[model samples]
Target: MKGFGLKVTETGAKSYIYQYRIGGRGSPTRRYTIGQHGSPWTPTTARTEAERLARLVGQGFDVVAQRQENERKSVSLAMPAYVEAFITNYLTTQWKDEADGAATLRKHVVPVLKSKSFPSLTRSDITAVIDKIPAGQMATRRKVFAILRKMIRWGIGRGDMPQQDNPLVGFEAPPAPASRDRTLTDGELVLAWNAADDLGYPFGPMVRLLIALGQRREETSAMEWNELDAASGVWTIPAAKSKNGKAHIVPLNDVALAVIDGLAGCADSAKSANSANSARRWPKRGLLFSTTGKTPASGYSKAKARLDKLMVDAEAKRAKETGDSAELIDAWRLHDLRRTMATGLQRLGVRFEVTEAVLNHVGGSKAGVAGVYQRHDWKEEKRDALQAWGRFLEQLAAGEPEQSNVVHLAARG
Candidate 1:
């Protein structure tokens, strides 16, 4: 009776009430309307309501404040709603530079969790969705999980969600994947280089350019004629196109220049003759490697598969010629060529700073205060290193053994 009461009006309407002192004795005790005392709110039901409020008071929550907060976020501030708000307002705007990060959330996280109300997103539901993703693509799963966790934290901090307990608190993420550092040996490089040439046109030229320039695959793939300075032998990767968000000046060696020349000729021949043969490699005049100028170069997976077979055939042919069993090279990715070039420079004793400069790495020794102070672009060093490597590649392609010990300055003098 102390915590509960009944009210009756002249019209015979009756209701239940629960009252509580805010600041103890002599302070104003507030009465909360529990329910109308009728079918649903009999004395027994009204008593239960009083008991619930009493427990809440014991737990130190101002039930009135919580109700108001819940009411505020009722429909428009639901879980999915807050998630979208986070993406549009926070992820997209404040973190504008990380477009890929926002895209991943919008693409992967939004669709799966959009309909799920924020309060309804339990650990089990999160785990269930994660479990369905195949183990072969754990890396993607891990990213999605991480993004979702961040979203939950953001909601909690902003008071969009109940300001307690992270839904993903104890759930473990899939192991972070190992970074790929695969590199092709000199033999593999020569074999693959020849194999790419035999493959012909687009994929061939793209592969050669990747190895030739040691640039990223997409950068090589998205090349435009305008980016090339034929006379100076510089293939400029514009800031927008480069991964590091810096314009990269790749000093092209004779072989790289020759490959570019061959590709341009191939594209010209295809266009003049009105053939679709080069259409896949040269979508338009400006594009150097794309199948369609509107998009970056594609068919990488399929093209790589074809290149593998060609390499194996090259191995077989060599075996037949030498009267010895020739073993095909080990498996590798297009990125391995980039690594191989970096490794080759180091093995040849080229300065690591120059190597980093050629790769356009924004971090490591090339970055931070050290990078700021070391304003030297190492342009001349990079050119020398690339030219030396190009000569080695030419020798290998022509069946002449590599002269790795040759000193550039000594030879010049």
Candidate 2:
């Protein structure tokens, strides 16, 4: 009671309360709730600890301030602070807002390098991570590296980490080997088209669009009703969602238009059947394809799983009928369908620039300059190009005018 202060109460409460004075200007008194009557801190022990704290405060120590200061000083490193800021601010706000970016970072970069000091990461460390991934995954490595570089740059810009050159700078992986030529041969094209037709649930239209337009898989899957201009025969992909961050205008051929029309019919039929429950059955927003009709399909994971099973079944059937080994038929991928379109267009004498523009690829030397200057979509040229490609595919499907031996000879020569 002499060295420390105390409060007494007489209203049937059996315990005394401890009191202390805070040392700033007003010197307001604070109380610590030790215990009621028969628990942990006895009066003597509470008094001693309070005396110690009081002594420290009397000497301008300010124990609470000191503890906070110690905590502030304890957070001295860049990596832990970065991780906190990245999880709270960057991942939650910026990266997560973008479609699939959070998953990409979490799956690819965070698992490997989240704990690493931004300043200490070296090109060799990055290359080691890259090397661990199996060969032929150059695209995946490139994307992971890009995400890491961006995160590091963000940290540096925000002053959370020291400025360092991005470790991914000049980091190059070996070219992925050209796997089996995705280009479908004339016979294979016919076979795949027929197969798609026989198994139609939209596979036929999907295949036709993939072959006719040569758009990326996700781009095709993300296509919305609002993006299509049936009258103008143009499908415009907005810049924000595009991989290149530029608006891409695809000139739709008659074949592509027909496919869209067919899909519209299917959608109409589904809606008609569900008319009584239309609000529940159809999505509020427009998506070309949706699961139960609410939001756009996020990924092709389910569809891809089903397709993989189908491919396995197709291979088994091929093996049984043709006596071909399993290895021979398991060689194709979905992306091969796009390659087939490109190769088929090339084989039909379409100009390289026209094909590249149709595919929305960065143009070649001459066309690159033209692409900058022209400012136009080159809609007419693209239309002609796509129409010609579609006609070629139709011919292949019909087996009309057999594929030329001369073309094969020229290819060999």
Candidate 3:
């Protein structure tokens, strides 16, 4: 009776309680309610389990510690849950303020890792996922590894799992190959401008504005009528619309001003021909460039397709007359125009800071230091830079400068 003892307690109409006492002098008896006497675990199962527990305890074994150890091993085996908890708690909530960082992880990281358990995930598994991504996306892969490391660290902090000691810690994908810097040559600019003019579509003026002002396609596409100062010949791009999150002042050269004037004329013409209600319905959010059906243009895919066709036609015509391959003079992209403007400025002997400021490149000295200290808007310098660029464009258009060269001023000049 030393290792085994039991006591019966209350009977609530039909219920009964049982108790057990461990062996020894001062040890107190412990009560364990075995269900209603008639039910399963009846007297038989309870007695069997209790006796087993007593024997294990007598051997210096801790049942509670054993159960906990089993549980720890089970949890260690559940890899999928750890990955899910890490992504939900850390990636979504903890790093929520990193702009689109959370979205990128959810889209790219979660799907692949959701079914994979932590212990099973190897360095090769990570590398395999990264390799499937196009080589051009090496930067994106590097960023993804950082997010994964953060997620694993978060799991360790919660005490639900051990540290992953991230296998991807020092892994680096090869640098993405550099793409061709396809800034337009002077002759190409002339062909594109002429083709745009001949097409005589809404994109014509927009293309002119892009070339003259060197604004990003999205910035120009989202431009509002209110942002334009026709009298002062300036177009103000708001900070939110700008890539650097800073407002920019672009001096509207004569060509850019003319394009805006033409747009205004077209809007007035639409108003005159329609009923008052119809005229009011005309998208007057003051968008300078809009879709053909009067809504603001949201994307450039359709427009680019049309532009590409026009360039193809022009190239074919040139090829037939001169016996040159059409591929030699094909369509250029809208982005290339910005590069053309930058290269054009560089060729005009414009200062590097001035050129970078015009392009809104953030890494330049003027972007960081002078952007703060030289608080004076450098309005004249900007005007001079744009005017020089415009004149160079005109010379190119006129076919005066057959070859493009960076113009440098001599000390005597």
Candidate 4:
């Protein structure tokens, strides 16, 4: 054959040759010299040699082809490929509504694990990443463990990851979450409420609402006018927004309503400034307390820092008159307000079940089997409890400390 060649000239010489494309059909063809015939290569040997080359070509294992396949396999097997797939496919469909879950992955999990292989990922690898998160951030540590549990379970479910080989498979995995019981005292509540006023407008009202409503930070911060019924004094938190995955009707008292009204005044004032031209431009719908009405209130960290400073200044002023330093107010988080509300409700003699209902909790009498049977909305009782609690809060916040639930003993006796 000319290609598997035998070339005989005046000085007879014979040789073998091969020609093929590196990448199939449209690729430029390449030719390679095999061996000469008549010296080491006879016609039979040349034919045998050509047969071996044909086998290699058919099996797709020529040097160039093998190299390309190896590169493809390397890329397919890479960790980044799996991470991208998991976030794109799993997180979007399954965890789409979970903002905090998504944030945890982006902030803590994804950064450390984006390029890490599932098979090679070890316990130490997970632990090291967690340890890098600043200590005392137990909540964040717990969240990381939660994300790992979900991601590892997701991988194992998908069948590529073997359960026995799973790095996250363990008896004692996530550390027990730290319990919080810090309730601001009535006097401290008043001090904090006043300080919140100095913080001003959205943050001030936000902090007050945190104390007044006992709703979660995310729910209150993202409050929309649509969620509130001004006429009925009801704020309907839809199942989509609620933590318990249940629709909750929270009855706002006068104090809570007034805070919202103040926010409305600000918005109306902004509209009135350019009502003719900017009527459409002003966001009249979305958030009750946002600079741009399309979004929810943010700047919590900075706003809280300012509120803390105001508390410190107030404490110093009190100490200046008293000559004894009134205990400097302890550093408190905004969440403490919710706890204070729960505790305060009990002090005001709000019934236990009603209190839990106000908090929209599923625990206590509402948990497990009881939750299945107890379908009652407790709407009237919840409304009463919130109204009663709201009234008690107004008394304290209005600087009437002399009238707290104290009884004169000796005179009555």
The Cα local distance difference test for each model comes to 0.73, 0.61, 0.63, 0.71
Model 3 pairs in collision? 225-286
lDDT of 1 by residue, 1-413 (tens): 67789988999988898888766688677777888978899999889889999889777777666777767766556645666677777775444233455656666665666666676678877876677667766677897787778777777787766855567877888787678778987778877887887777689888987887788876787788888765466778888778877788888876676677576653332121112332323223477765665545566778999999998898899899999888858888888898999999898788888889988987788767997798887878888889877777766665656565432211111
Top TM-score model: 4
Q: Write candidate 3's Cα lDDT for 235-330 as tens digits.
A: 788886777777998886645655665677633322211123322122234677666544445435566677667777887888899998876654
lDDT of 4 at 241: 76
Candidate 2 lDDT over 1-413, as tens digits, reads: 64354445777554545555665547876555444554555677776677777677668665666667755644533445555556566665555234355555565554666566656777876776666666666766766666667777776787655665656567674465555665656655555554554445544456557766788766776678788765466789877556666788888765566566566753322221112543212222376755545534454444445555555566568778999775343346567877778777788788777777777777573355666776656668877878777667656655566534212110111
- Candidate no. 4 TM-score: 0.71
- Shift of residue 252 alpha carbon in model 1, Å: 1.4
- Stretches off by above 4 angstroms in model 3 are 1-180, 197-204, 266-284, 292-302, 322-327, 330-332, 367-371, 401-413
lDDT of 4 by residue, 164-209 (tens): 8877767355566578888898878877877877888789888978
Clashes found in each candidate (C-alpha, N, C closer than 3 A): 0, 0, 1, 0
Q: Which residue window of length 10 is worst by lDDT in model 1? A: 267-276
- Candidate number with the higher TM-score (3 or 4): 4
Residue 158 alpha-carbon offset, candidate 1, angstroms: 13
